[model samples]
Each structure stands twice: as structure tokens, then as C-alpha cells.
Target: MTLEELFAPFGLKAPPLRVLGLTLDSRRVEPGYVFVAVPGVPLPHRKPLDGHDFIPEALAKGAIAVVGERELSLPVPYLRVGDARGALAHLARHFFGEPDRKLALLGITGSKGKSTTASLLHHLLQAGEKPAALLSTVGLRLGKEARPNIGHFTTPEAPEVYGFLREAVERGLEAAVLEVSSHALALKRVEGLSYRIGVFVSFYPDDHLDLHGTAEAYFATKALLVERSHLAVLNTRLPHLKRLLPRPHLLFGPGGEVWGEGLREGEEGLRFTLHTPWGSGEAFLPMLGRYNLDNALAASAAALAYGLSLEKVLQGLATFRGVPGRMEVVQKKPFRVVIDFAHTGKSLEEALKTLRATTRGRLLLVVGAAGERDPRRREDIGRVAARLADKTFFTEEDHRTEDLQAILEALAKAAGEEGGLYEIIPDRKEAIFRALSEAREGDTVLLAGKGHERTLERGTLALPWDEKAVALEGLTALGLGGGEHP
Candidate 1:
């Protein structure tokens, strides 16, 4: 398409320069590409380069057109827009032939359970013989092929989103499930796309305070998805979210359209009777925790909203094992070791509470807070650990450019004098070893933070790290080969 045609969506006139693709990164610019120069926000660990500074580099890379907040005096066609990020979304949508319109898009956004809900919905659609794709905190799946999300972003950049959607359409996929984050909405990363069904799992006042400035602002950003969605699926338990409910919306929770009764938690999984508008049926999910039952209900509600049968939803839920690093049980022997991505205070509390109930003996917890992120929850997490666990080990978790000792000390202080059972270990592997080495028969160790992640961020480097792998190594070093407890 010509540069003029591409900028026409933004109501800007451009020279008749042909373009092959669009990009924000100068390094990705190819011959005949249209580059969008969006300003970057300064982060705690690293400062982003101003896209305006890369104009010359992008031009040298054979970019035929440039989109920016301000016009530039360049030989190539230059188009100025009020918001370059929003313009990028529009241009990408136009370039990709609006793939979102061609595919059924379901967006699940909240402070928690997005990954689980998206994965379950995708599994339901696929099991029903309906073609579907998924994008979540865990990974990206296209049909039968899936890969880990090494990028570590819940919602990818707009270009990648459109690119993936285009590929899904090319492959004849009928639906796409995405886990949308609050940061993505705040940054306008998902500007031009609309969702067929948007689900709100749950909310809490944690994380991303440095960016959003206040809890209200953070929630306002999340509400954007509900505003733009054709059908909104909300958790009625969260009273604040009820204002977002529109006509044709489905509420799920206690006293909602999709509710759970006779909830029973067992060591293996959860067995609950689901009460839905379609009918009431018994459902058993092969996963731990009550929060997971809520996740299952959210996914089932979304599938039903998308026109799937209740039987298919139950079948999919039954066959579905679980998402990795989400209360993932790595061992069930002399002592059970579970790996989970419960970094927030509320999530950590839920995890510890669930384990405390089922654990046969003492419950030990390994926990840490990420550096350069929200520090407000560190104390809350420590407090939760102090109240619930028999022993707590505070260790390193993504201490990017921050002193690991300081982070550990803050948590230690939060545990206070009353909680004397906790110890601070700067090295994560040693902390895991200490926790496992001290464990006896019938004890359970909960490893929080860094679930499916394969790297540990220290300073500016992401060293290779995996919690389950490290735990296995610790077990081997201690001469305790893999075995289950009687």
C-alpha cells in the first residue's frame, strides 16, 4: 500500500510512497517500511530510547515513511499524529487487513487469574473442535503448537498482536484468547482492537503503583477493556467492577449467573457443582485451590457466552491438567514442593491458605519480591508468610539494578520480631536448598514467585534460572532422589 493510503486512516495526507511493512523499532525497519516514532517512558531499571532520535537511523534503514507526534523535515514522507502509539495500532490494523474482525477475540484482564482463564478458554474451544489461538502470561499458542512467553509481557506490543492475529487468520483459526494486562491498556498497546467477550477474573490493590500513581487510576485503566468489549463477563464478588456491567453482560460468582455450589477441595483437585444458566452439573477440575475453581467458572462462562455447549465446557475442564507454575506440584513425596507465580500479597495469601488446609504437617514458604517494581506489597506478602507458614525463607527474585540485600531486609523487617521462624538468604538456590534440606516427612514447601520463568534478573542481566529445575538439583545434592510420600 502507498504511504498516503496508510496515513489516511489518521486523516493525514502523505506522499505516494509505497511501503512494505510498519514498525516502531528502527532495527526492524526494512526497505519501504513505515516507522512510527513513539516516545518512551522512563522505567526504574532502564530508560527507553526516544523514537524521534532514531529517525535518521530508520531512514538509513530504508524506511519510506515516518509517523511521529511532531512533523520532521525529512526527504521521506512524514506524517504527524497526536498519539504515535495509537496511530501505530491503527496502521497495524489496516496493514494486517483488520484480522481481529475476522477472528473471534476473547480478552481476559485482571490483577490475577488471566493466564489460567485464557488457557482454559483456549482449551475449551480447541477440545470442542473449534479452531482457536491463545496469548497469555504463560505463552503463545497457535493451534497445536505452543511456546513459552520469554518476552515476559502479558499483552505484547500492538504490532506483534496484529501480526499474530493475521497469522491465525491465515491458518483459518476461528477464535483468539488473550490475557490483557493493565499496563497494556494504560500504554495504549491494545488500542485499535475490540474484543467479542471481555472477562474480569478478580482485582486487588497491588503492583504497578509506580506507573498508575493510584489504585483508582490502575482500575480505571483495566475498565477500558470492559468499555470497548461487545459482551462483558464480570466477577460480581468485586463490587467496584459492577459499575462496568453493561447490557447483555454475564456475572459469575456467588449469586451470579454462573455460580459454584457444594465446593469440595481435595489433595488431587477440586470437585464442585456448577450452577449455570444452561443447567446445573457436577464439575471436577484436576487442579488445586479455590481460586482455580473461580478461574474455571470464568472460563466456562466465557465459553458459554461464545456459544459453546455446557457439556463441551465441562469435558474441556475435566481433560485440562493445569497451567505450569500456577500452584504446580513438582513433588508429592516425603514432602510436597509446589511452584507458583504468586507474587502479589492477596495471591500469596490465597495460595498459603489453600496449602495450609491440605498439608498434612508443617507448611514452609519460600518467598521474595521483585526489584524495581511495586514495593507496597512486599510487607503484605511477608506478613502473610509470617502468619501462615511454619518457616519462611526470603530470597532473591528479579532484583534488577537494586540491592538484593535491601529487598530481603525490607521483607525481613516486615516479618517483625514476633515472626522469628523466618530467615533471609540472598542467593535463591541456597534458599531453596535450605528449605528442602530441613523438610521432614509430611511437610510441604511452597515456592512463590518465578513460576514458569526460565531466568533470574540480577542487575541488568537475566541469568538462566528455573525454580523446578533448581529444586530437583537441590534434591539430588541432598541425596533424596525423586519419590512420593506414603
Candidate 2:
């Protein structure tokens, strides 16, 4: 598309340039590409790398045009906009033929449960025989094909977001489910894309404080999903967010349009009666934790909003196994071992609470926090473990360029002075081994923080790491059954 045609939607005259593609990263610039020089937020221990500094590099790489907030003197065409990120979103939408309009887009945003909810909705739509695609923390899916999303962010850049939807359109997919992050909304990565339905699962003070600066700002960024969506699916349990939904919306949780009752938790899974606007039905989810039930409710509400029946939603929930790394069961023999991505205090508390209820014996926790992100959450994680776990092991989890001992000590300090049984293990693999070795019969071991992630980030290096495999190996070494519990 010509620059004029692309910028027409934004009411700005396009420069005299032909664009073949768009990118934010200068390294990815190619012939006839329009590079956007958007400034990025600086995180802890990292220098702010602005795209404006790389204009020369982009030009050298054959970028035909540049989009930025400031005008630049260059041989190539320059298009100035109030917000470069928003401009990229508009350009991407125009370039991709506005694929979101061709397909039904469902966006799920919150501090947690995004991946599981998005995946569940995708599974439900597919189970109902509707052509659907998924973009989540786990990966991307179109039709029957799924692949891991190697991008560092949950919601990729504007180009990638529209590009994926465009591909979904080509694949003949009728709908798409996306796990929209607060950063994505704040950065305008998902700008110009409208969702058929948006789901707010739950909120908590968690990661990305460095970018957002405050908990309220973080929440406001997430609240954008509700504002831009055609319809909002809200979790009524979080009363603080209720005021954000003054307009018409579908509610979930207690006394909401979709809620769960008659809840029963066991080693096998959970059995609950799912209440929806359409109707109500008993759902036996082969997944652990009440939080998962919340995720199920969110997905069910979204699916029902898309014209799916309650029976189909229940069937999809029943047939669905679970999302990888989110409360995944590794083994069930003398005791139970679960791997979960419970990095936040809220998620950790919920996971431990559920395990404590179901576990007949002691609840053992192996948890840690990522370095160079939010240090405050480190203590919160420790405090949660201190309150719920019979024994806790504070170990290394993605301590990129940060002092390992300092991170462990912070966690140990937050564990409180109640004289709880805890240990500081810097080595993650050894920590898992020690936890498993100390476990007696009927004890439930939870390996939290690193769930389905296959690698461990340590000081700018991504080492091969698998929590489930490591737990299974530890079980096998103890002569316990490595197979999953039936």
C-alpha cells in the first residue's frame, strides 16, 4: 500500500514512499520497510534502547520510510505522528486489510489467568466445531496447528499482531482469542483492533511495576481492554473493578451471569456446577485449583457471548485437559507433585491454598522470583509460602544478572519470623531434588514460578530447563512412579 493510502485512516497525509512492510526493530528492517522509532520503557539494570537511535541502521538496512514522533532529516521519506506506536498499529491494520474485521477477536486481559482463559476459549470454540485461532503466552494456534511463541512479550508488536490475524484469515479461521497484556495496551500494540468480546479474569499487584510505575496505573492499562471491546466479560469477585463496568456487561463469579457452585476438589480434579446466562450444568474439570475454575468461568462466559450454548461450553470444559505449566500435574504416586507458573503473590497464595486443602499430608513448596523485574514480589511470594506451606524452599528463578544470594535472602526475609520450616537453595535443580527427597507419603510438592517454560534465564543466558521433566527425574530417582496420576 502507498504511504498516503495507509495514513488516510489516521487523517494524516502519507509521505511520498511505497511501503512493503513495517517494523519497530531496526535489525528486522528490510527493503521498502517502514521502521517505527518508538521509545521503550527502561527496566531495572537495563539501558533504555530507543528506536530513534537506530534510524541510521534502519536506513542502511534498506528501510524506505521512517515513522516517529519527531521529524528527521534523511534521504528516505519521514512521516511524523503524535504517537509512533499508535501510528504503527494503524499502518499494520491497513497493510493487513484489517483482518480483525474479517474474524471475531476475543481478548482476555488481567494480571493472571490470561493464558489459561484464552486457551480454554480457543478449545471451546474448536470443540463446538468453530474455526478458531489462539495467541497466548503458551503460543499461537491456527486451525489444528500450534507453535510456541518465542517473542519476549505476551502481545507481540503491532505488525505481528495484525500479521497473525491476517494469517488466521487466510487459514479460514472464523475467530481468534488473544491474551492481551497490560504492556501491550499501554504501548498501543493492540491499537485499532476491536474484540468481539473481552474478558477480565482477575487483578492483582504483580509484575511490570517498572514500566507502569504504580499499581493503579497498571490496572488502568489493563482496563483498556474493557473500554475498547464490543462486549465486556467481568469477574464480579473482584469488586474493585466493578466500577469500571458501568455499561452493559456479562458478569462471572458469585451472583454473576456465570458462576460455579457445589464445588468439590480432589486429587483427580474439580467438579462444580457451572451457572451461565444460557443455562447451568455440572462440569468435571480434570484440572486442579479453584482459580482454574475461575478461568473456566471466564472462558465459558466469553464462549457463551459468542453464541455458544452452555452444553457446548461444558463439553469443551470437560474434554479440555489443561494449559501447560499452569498447575500442571507431573506425577501422583506416594504423593502428588505439581508444576505451576505461580510467580505473583495472588497466584502463589491460591495454588498453595488449593494444594493445602487437597493434600492429606504436608504441603511442600519450591518457589522463587525473577530478578531484575519486581523485587517487592519476592517477599510477597515468600510470605505466601510461609503462611500456607509446611515446608518451603526459596530457590533461583531467572536471576538475570542479579545477585542470587540477595534474591534468596529477600525471599527468606519475607517468609516471616514465625519460625516456619524453610531453606534457601540457590541451585534450582538441587532445590527440586531436596524438596522431593524430603517429601514423605501423601505429601504434595509444588514447583512454582517456572511452569511450562523450557528454559531458565540466568545472567543473559537461556539455559535448558524443564520443571516437569526435572520433577519427574527426581521422582524416578526416588524409585517413585514417573507416570502421571490416572
Candidate 3:
């Protein structure tokens, strides 16, 4: 497509330069590529990263044209728009052939449980004999093939997201489940895509406060997803859910369109009879956290709304193993060592409480808070850790350029308020080793924060980190579990 042809939809006159591809990153700009200069987060000392500054580099790299928020005279065609990110998203949609028009799309959004819910929907689609793709925190799955997504961004930039969707459509996939993040909605990363069903799992006001500036604004941005969706699948119990979405929605909870009865949780997992408008069936979710039962129902409602049978939904639920780092059990023999991606206060509380119920011995916790996001969450996390766990290890978790000692001390103070046994461990690996080494038979060690993340940010360095692998190594090195993985 030529530059003029691409911008014609926006009613803008452009040069007839042929465009081969699109990119937000100037580093990736190549000859014939249309570069969109989107602003990025600021580094420690550097000013807020802006694509405008890199236009020269992009042009030098042989970019045919540049689209940015700032108006500037350049050697190549320069189109200035009010929202460059939105323009990028739209142009990416156009460039990718608007795959959403060809594929049924389901968007799962909220503070937590998005990955599991999206995964469940993908599994249900496959179980119902509909080939689909999934883009979630765990990984990307198209048809029978799957790959781990190692990045921290749950929702990638517009180009990559649309590119993945286009690939899915090309591979003859009929549907896709996308795990939407607040940043994605706020930045117009998913501007042009249409969602057949938007799933609301759970929301934490404190989550992404650093990005949205206020809790009200955070929720308002999140509400945009359901507002754009053809149907919203929401939890009936969350009062805020009904308020945010007024359109046609499927509520999954007591007295809602989809509800569960005869719920049971044990060593195996959860078993509940799911009741929906279309049909009803007994469902068993092979996942921990009874709270996740609602997530399962949310996914079921989305699938049922997407034209899947209740039996297939239940089948997928039964066969679906939980996402990695989400209530993931690392070692199970002597003492249960579980690694989870529970970072927020609500999620951490839920994880700790759930483990407490199953623990015959003391409940051990190794938890930490990230730096530069929300300062209030550190207090919440520390208080929850101390109030619940028998013993808590306050340690480092993505403390990028922040004083690790101060963060640990803040946790100690919060734990002091709870009058619980707690110790500050600066090194994350050491904290895991200590937690595992001290755990006794029947005690469950919950490793909270940094689930499925391949890197740990401390100062400016993002070092390699694998929570489950580190826990297993700690167990083996401690001469506790068998040398081989459990």
C-alpha cells in the first residue's frame, strides 16, 4: 500500500510513496516502512522517550514516511496527527487487513485472572472443535502450537498484536482470545480491533495507578474494552461490573446469567456444576484458588456466547492445566513449594488465604513489591503477607533503580504492624532458598510476584529469573527434594 492509500481512510492527503510495512520503533525502521513515532516511558536519567527525537534515525534507516504527534518538516513525507499511537493502531489494522473482521475475537481484561480466563476460552474453543489462537501472559498459541511470551507486557504494541492476529487468520484460525491490559487501552494499542466478547475477571484499583494516575481513571480506561465489545462477560458479584457496562452482558455468578452450584475444592482441584442460559454441565477446573471458579465461569460464558456448548466448556475446564506461575506447584513431596504471579494486594491475599486452608503446617510466604509503580501497594502487600503467612520473607522484586533497602524496610514496618514473624532478605534467590530451606513437611511455601517473568529488574539491570526453576534448584541444593524435578 502507498502512503497516500493508507492515510486516505483518515481523509488526509499524502504522497504516493509505496509502504511495505509499519513500525513504532525507529530501530526497526527499514526502507519503504512507515514509521510511527510513539512516545515511550522515561528511563532513570533520560527524558521521557519520544519517537519524535528518533525521526532522523528512522529516516536515515530508509523510512518512506513518518507519522507522529508533533508536526515537523522532514526530507520524507511527514504526517502529524493528534494521537500518533491511535494512528499507528489504525494503520496497523489497515496494513494487517483488519484480521478482526475475519476472526472472532474475545478480549479478557481486568487486574487479575486474565491469563487463565483467556487460556480457558482458547481451550474451550479447541474442545468445541473451533481452531483458535490465544495471546495471553503465559504465551501465544495458534492451533496446536504454543510459545511462551517472555515479555512483561501482557498486551504488546499495536503492530505485533495485529501481526499475530493476521497470522492466526492466515493459518485458518476462526477465533482468538486476547489478554488486554490497562496500558493497552490507555495508549490506544488496541484501538481499531473489535471484540466479539470482552471478559471482565477481577479489578484492583491500585493496579496500574502509576499509569492511569487515579483509580477512577484506571477503571474508566478498563471500561472502554467492554464498551466496544459486542458482548460483555462479567462477574455478577462485583458491583462495579454492572455499573461499568450497561450494554448486553453475561454475568457469571449467583443469580446471574451464568452461575455455579455444588462447588467443591480439594487436593485435586475445583468441581462445580455450571449453569448458563444455553445449557448446564458439571465442570471441574484443574486449578487452585476457589476464587478462580468465577474466572472459569467468565470464560465459559464468553465461549457459550461465542456459540460453544456447555459440555465443551466443561470439558475444556477439566482438561485445562492452569497457567505457569499462577498457583504453580514447584515441589510437592516434603513441603509444597508453589510459585505464583500474585503481585497486587488482593491477589496476594487470595493466594495466601487459599494456601492457608490447604496447609497442615505453617504457611510460609516469600513476597515483594515492584518499584516505581504504586507506592501504596508495598504497604498492602507487606500487611497482607504478615497478617496471613506464619513466616514472611520480605525481599526484592523488580526494584528498578529504587533503593532496595528502603523497600525492604517498609515491608518490615508493615509486618511489624501485624506483629508477625518476618525477615528482610535483599537477594531474591536467597529469599527463595531461605523460604524453602525453612519449610517443614506439610508447610506450603508461596512464592509471590514475578511469575512467568524471565527477567528481574534491579537498578538498571534486568537479570534472568525463573521462579519455579530457582525454587526447584533451592530444594535440590538443600537436599530436600529428589535431584530430578518433581
Q: Which residue segments of model 3 deviate by more than 4 Å? A: 2-4, 10-20, 30-32, 40-47, 241-246, 480-486
- Backbone clashes in candidate 3 total 0
Better of 1 and 3 by lDDT: 1
lDDT of 3 by residue, 1-486 (tens): 788999898777888888889998887889999999988864332347788889989989999888988868888777789888889999999988888899989999988889888888898898889999999888899988998773678998898899999999999999999999988998888898779898888777777766777788988888888888989888766537658556888888887889999999987789988888987888888888898888888888998899987777777888987788899887776788888999978899999989888899999999888887677788888888888999999899999877889888888888899888999989999999999889888899999998888899988888988888888788879896574333
List, residue by residue over 41-103, the lDDT tens digit for candidate 2. 777667877889999999999988788887677787677888888888988998999899999
lDDT of the structure predicted as candidate 1: 0.87
The C-alpha stretches of model 2 lying farther than 4 A from their native spots are 1-20, 30-32, 42-47, 205-208, 240-242, 416-418, 476-486
Each candidate's TM vs. the true structure? 0.92, 0.91, 0.93
Off by over 4 Å in 1: 1-5, 11-21, 26-33, 42-49, 54-64, 481-486
TM-score of model 1 (CA atoms): 0.92
TM-score computed on alpha carbons, candidate 2: 0.91
Candidate 1 lowest-lDDT run of ten: 477-486
Error of model 3, residue 366, in angstroms: 1.5
lDDT of 1 at 331: 83
The 10-residue segment of model 3 with minimum total lDDT is: 40-49
C-alpha lDDT of residue 295 in model 2: 89
Tens digit per residue, CA lDDT, model 1, 366-402: 9999988867678887888888889999999998888
